[model samples]
Target: MKTIGVIGGMSWESSTEYYRLLNRHAKARLGGHHNARSLMLTVDFAPIEANQRAGNWTALGDQLADAARQLERGGADLVILATNTMHRVYESIEQAIDVPFLHIADPTGNALRAAGITRVGLLGTRYTMEQTFYTGRLSERYDLETLIPNEAERADVHRIIYDELCHGNVNDASRAVYQRVIDELAARGAQAVILGCTEITLLIKPEDSALPVFDTTALHAQAAVDWAIEPV
Candidate 1:
């Protein structure tokens, strides 16, 4: 198996999910005692979060690129950025690495297309929702239409992500708010909801939504496993 490098800790809460899912998928695929061949370079989320809040993407990109380089030096064959919002700086990381950088969106987009889903409701950080990096890639690559919650709902989602979920505080009230947002999106003709934030799966699951729910973290980790174990 090829080594899968992880740039993680954009909040250790969700990075833990990536670590667990990667091993679970690997064990299920290869059976018995098998586990993913992986390397991880976890960053301190405090400074990264500060940069994000201040919109200092250049510094964030520099930090992530350094992480990718460290993974490459550690002999990783490919890399996965374990958080969705951090993928805004994916290109910088990619440019800094020789190995393949698996984009979290590619697997999600492919899964949606395979399921014949054309319209999806996305829930993530405000940057992911309002910006072009993620939604634009899905549209350009898969011909998918992405819908985000309205301004007020977007604020709620973003706040819950940073303040609650990233800190590992999952509240019942926050989950209810997310369900309402999903319901509203479904009413607006969203065929499925994309849990675009990696931390979202901590609160919402497939059974929580009326529409089909796609968890990007699981999908992204599974894709990494697939690539690592593919026959050469």
Candidate 2:
């Protein structure tokens, strides 16, 4: 198996999920006491969060780039950025490493396409919801129409991600609020709902919404597993 590198800890809660899922899927597929050949370089979340809040991506990108180089140097064959919002720096981070950085957006978009989803609703952190960096890539690169919740609902979703899920507290009440948002999105012509926050799939599931749900975390993890097991 190829070594998969992880640029993680935007919130280690979701990062932990990435590691677990990678191992779970790897063992299931290869059928042994196998775990993913992995290298994880976890960044300090406080500074990264502060940088995002201040709109200073230069330092954040530099930090991630440095981590990518380290993961490569540590014998990682492929890299995966373990957070959705932090993928804002994906381009620069990709340039910093020679190994493949499996974009969190690509596999999710591909999964949506494979499921026949054309228009989709997205729930994520404020930066991810409002920015063109992520949604633009899905729309322009993958030809998917992305619909974000309105400012009010967006704030609620963002709060749930940062103040709740990121902190490792999954609240049932939060899930109810998101369920309403998902219904509204389906009414707005969304064929599916994309959990753009890696931590969200932990709170809500497809059963919570009337439409199909594509989990960014699981799709990204599965894609990484597939790539890791491929012939070197």
Candidate 3:
């Protein structure tokens, strides 16, 4: 198995899910008590969050690039950033390391395409929702149309993500709020909803949404397993 290097802990809540899903899928694929060959460099999210709030993306990118370099030096075969929002620095991290950097969006986009989903709803931090980095990639690479919540709903989604989900606080009320947003997105003609934020999987599930659900964290982990077991 190839080693999967992870840049994690932008709110270790979702990072923990990445770890669990990676190992679990690896075992499921290989059987016989097999697990992923992996290394994780988890950073403190406090300063990272502060930097994001301050719009210090360059410094944040540099910090994550350093993390990717550390993982590569530690002998990782390929690298993955465990958070969706931190993917704002995807280019920097990709350039920092020699190994393949598995982008979080690729697997999700592939799955969406395989399912014949052309239009999708996205729920993530405001940066991910409003920025061109993520949605533009989907449009340009996958021919997918991305729709997001309205401004007020976007604020609520962002708040629930940082204030509650990041801290491991998953409330039924917040789930209801997310369901409402998903319904609106479906009404807007979204064929499926991308749980664009990694933490969102904790609150919303396949059965809870008005549209089909695509969890990026799960898809990314499964893709890592596929990469690990593929013949070189």
Where model 2 places Cα greater than 4 Å from the true spot, the runs are: none
Sorting all predicted structures by TM-score, with the top scorer first, yields 1, 3, 2
Residue pairs clashing in model 2 are none
Give the C-alpha lDDT of model 2.
Answer: 0.91
Candidate 3 colliding pairs: none
| Least well predicted 10-residue stretch by lDDT in candidate 1 | 223-232
- My TM-score estimates for the predictions, one after another, are 0.99, 0.97, 0.98
lDDT-superior candidate, 2 or 3: 3
lDDT of 2 by residue, 127-189 (tens): 999999989999988899999999999999999888999899999899999999998998999
lDDT of the candidates, in the order given:
0.96, 0.91, 0.94
Each prediction's number of clashing residue pairs: 0, 0, 0
Candidate 3 local Cα displacement, residue 89, angstroms: 0.9
For model 1 the local lDDT of residue 97 reads: 89
The residue-by-residue lDDT of candidate 3 on 103-160, one tens digit each, is 9999999999999999999999999999989999999999999999999999999999
What's the CA error at residue 155 for candidate 3, in Å? 0.2
